[model samples]
Target: MFDKIYDVIVVGAGHAGGEAAAAAANMGSSTLLITMNLQNIGQMSCNPAMGGIAKGQIVREIDALGGYSGIISDETAIQFKMLNKSKGPAMWSPRVQSDRMRFSEEWRLKLERTPNLDFYQEMVGGIVVEDGKIVGVKTSLGLTARGKTVVLTNGTFLNGLIHIGDKQFGGGRAGERASTGITKELTDLGFETGRMKTGTPPRVDGRSLDFSKMEVQPGDVDPEKFSYSSSTKPLTKQRDCHLSYTSPQVHEMLKEGFDRSPMFNGSIKSIGPRYCPSIEDKINRFADKDRHQLFVEPEGWNTVEYYINGFSTSLPEDIQFRALREVAGFEQVKFFRPGYAIEYDYFPPTQLKHTLETKLVSGLFFAGQINGTTGYEEAASQGLMAGINAALLVQEKDPFILKRNEAYIGVLVDDLITKGTEEPYRMFTSRAEYRTLLRQDNADFRLTPKGYDLGLASEERLREMEIKQKKSDAFVGFFTNTSVPPEVLNPILESKDSALVTQSDKMIRPFSRPNITMDDMRKIETVEAFIRENELDTEVLQQAEIQIKYAGYIEKEKNNAEKLNRLEGIKIPENFDYTRLKSLSYEATEKLSKIRPVTVSQASRISGVSPNDISVLLVYMGR
Candidate 1:
């Protein structure tokens, strides 16, 4: 027995589903979130951390667009650090080590307080579809809840199987059971499914380890929070993580379990994340290496549990314990939970559109690990975008799809829906072609306007952004128009190892190369006075500096983005008989027919499609 209808229904309550439900409800849509266990909402399943490298940028972008990830992360964080401080602004990412219990509790509390959001404790078994469109979902207890749109964020629960050495059993995680019925039902409905594997390291008791021998890795002295929300503050006190390395003895011990290891023993047929391989795999692959590093991270401020990072394994408990003891400073380690590998069903993202909806089923969407993505930031960003689009779809508004040039989230989605991934995809600065223009410091400037239009971002945020933009623009203009005399600014320039200016020139110009700072702009008393009165935040100042210093590169990227947009706008007719075109290769025809890309740009991106094939299609379209 259930309600007549909800605007949106989200299955599962991990990172993706939690954010999806909150976002849809926050946007004024009636939402229902269904999960097998409500007590574990937003569980940090893999690591007790949030935001790292490129993933941190995604969280900031989500926060700027009014998503809850950053807020939850900020509230629960036990330690905060800004990664890559010595690097360019493009690479700076804010990360936090969170208290596992607090992170989950904060998520549940926040969801409970959110308006238009309702929670139900149940496992969704199958979707109710009519005329190739999703109408609702069927739960394990035979209860059916109808909704206009349904987002499935099943995580690693769909027909899940866990492996440890020679033993294998049905399970989502260590204590949770696997979800059944949905995979088979979807397969019968012509949805193709594949198995993906992921693993987590063992959790050890902090008191069992000797801290005197390990190197201490403490959080930043002046830490930064992830959220743009007013409720957060910078971290004052921080936790200290220890660093230790695996010894030859540890590697030798692990090898004894190789034959029984599910991954190497051929018991597991699923593909796992290539980047985050288990310790066994690493040892096997790098047989000659004497040691591998492991981070001893605390689970929380209050708990005595620590995550033994870089020790992910599915070997027998005896082997695991023995190997762990061989490592430096782990002579008496005790495990809170044993490491295991999980295999779960995932429909390859090649079947999804840019809006995160299934191409085969209207009003049906996917997010998180269900989409073969691995990180919390990846899942949360997808949930936010998918939720926004689902709400817009219900209101008969245009779908909101971010482009590759716009954000890291945009690049992530585009890569998923376009080329697709054979393995779990993680974000990195190297993945973004125009990262110089897509820095983390300016996420608000990049996305707040769209969020404001969608009713997600607040007016105050927009106003603040607008004010910042105006001030930065005025300052940049003043720097260009009013130049410093060589006599006044030469010593300052020389001190920074920059060439002394011969005449009045723009401070950001190459003539003032390598050492342009706000101090240099102080040569103009008006500019100096303005900076004193405004006292802009470091983030704003950095963003403004990047815009001014890299103006040419930014413009070039925007022009290239425009050129790419032209191909994106060109529509390709579906089921257009690619087989009949003799000019196309056999591989191109097969791939084009399968993917049925909506645009010429998408067609060009498909793995097997060649440039010649694209030219033939372009000619056929009479472009």
Candidate 2:
């Protein structure tokens, strides 16, 4: 039914596809977003939550880079929390418990309003290739839509198979049919495929729960959102979640279904997330531990459905209910839907370039679970990058590739394309090497400019950032130039467990500490007045403090990054044969030939490529 050639076409409307479509369309590309079911756009398949640890930093980066994930999350969140608040600035991450239905609704509406984006409700079965390049897609309905570039974000939907106990069905998620054709076509086209499994816990009815017997977990009194847009407000009232624990008795009851469990039986074979294991797996792995904590989270503000976190299992319904009742507060638990495992197709990301385009197929890109990533943040970040680069390819512009030091998205994509995950990869703070420079609070500081330059971030955003930067600089200058009297500063410093300043020494050094607050600065009317007059956000103030306090470390990291950049700047030819290099070890040669890293710096970071091998290669190149 269509004859127009679009600039970008995105298949699937999950977090990754949604962000990809929005980004490319917003950047002035004529984009068409085709999905199996438009109503389920942005459906949170596994959980009704967003952002945690390093994942939260990614959402903030997405926000600063003109993606709508954070904005929609903020608009639909039931409760908000800043995780790891007690830790360093690098560790602080913003998390939200969302109203699932509203989240999907908000995302659909946002996409509808976005210019240059067209929505089509249908499942794409295969891509149309011409002269070794992807030129369009073919849907299940037998219609072909042409596009300059296509981004495939088919999240857990391609030839999906769901297993509950012994029963199996074709579905991307519970109650949703699995997509076919694309995986088979791609495989036939010489692309390698692998299977990955992810599971969701049972949804329990909140109305039947006994709150009096459970410990209440509430949101912060003053809830903070993740979006830069002020269109969405923080929740005034939030539902309280309950905490429960799995006991030995519950473990014993779950084991009864071992013979029927699809995971244990030869019915299904695929690797799942290592971090988030099912209750049965947890019990079997940690046999010594008597209990495992489970959180009873609400699925939405209006719905009575509750997600039984940490209680994920592929056990039968009867066994699930019996085991759940034995837990602390789930005595009257009512299940909305039983938990099950879903196996779907994914291509090893090693076959794709750092730009997310497959090395085997030109103009074809894969992201999200299709690339073997597990979280919404991981998927969304990949979607943004892929969409941006796809649109850039259409415009004949240079690719937009972020380095490990630039953004967490960079580190995430780098890790996947380099290492090639054998299991579902989830984002963790520990995974990032330069996390100290990649704080969520300063995501806008690091990426807004890039987004603005890319035409995704609006001029207003750049203007506002410029204003904030100037104000912060002025404030820092004042802090450095203006000195506090020893009499005035001594008492404050002493109270804060800091040594008293002598004469007119600057309070900037001591003021940078975490314990130092605006209340302490009230002693000096000037600092307080400046802060009050500027209406500075606590996050901005905290970022400024970190900038001053860790100035030395930040500078050192910049220098190191610059040195690394020199090696990264030295581009390697695409057809360069590592096997021909006699100076490289066999192992290094094998690894380098496989990954085919674009830079000497990336080659050095490859697991099997040693520094000595890199040195030898560098000498051979006369560098």
Judging by TM-score against the true structure, name the best candidate. 2
- Give the runs in model 1 whose Cα sits over 4 Å from its true position: 510-512, 515-528
lDDT by residue (1-623, candidate 2, tens digit) is 77699999999999999999999999899999999999999999888999988999999899988899998998888888888978777899899998999999999999999999999998899999998899999988899999999999999999999988889999999998999999888998889899999898999888888877778889888888897654567778887777878888988999899888987887778998999998878988999998999998998888999998898888777888888998877888888889999999999998899999998889999999999999999999999999999999999999999998999999999899888899999988898878888888778888999999999988887777776777777777767777788887788888889766778777676677667765677678777888888887665566667777777778887888888889998878888888778988999999889889998888888888888999987876679
List CA RMSD, all candidates: 2.0, 1.5
Estimate candidate 2's RMSD in Å. Answer: 1.5
lDDT of 2: 0.88
Report the Cα lDDT for candidate 1: 0.87
Tens-digit lDDT string for candidate 1 (202-280): 9999999999989999999878888776678888888898899998989999999999999888988888899899999
Worst 10 residues of 1 by lDDT: 506-515
Clashes of each: 0, 0
- Model 2, C-alpha of 293: deviation from truth (Å): 1.1
Clash pairs detected, candidate 2: none
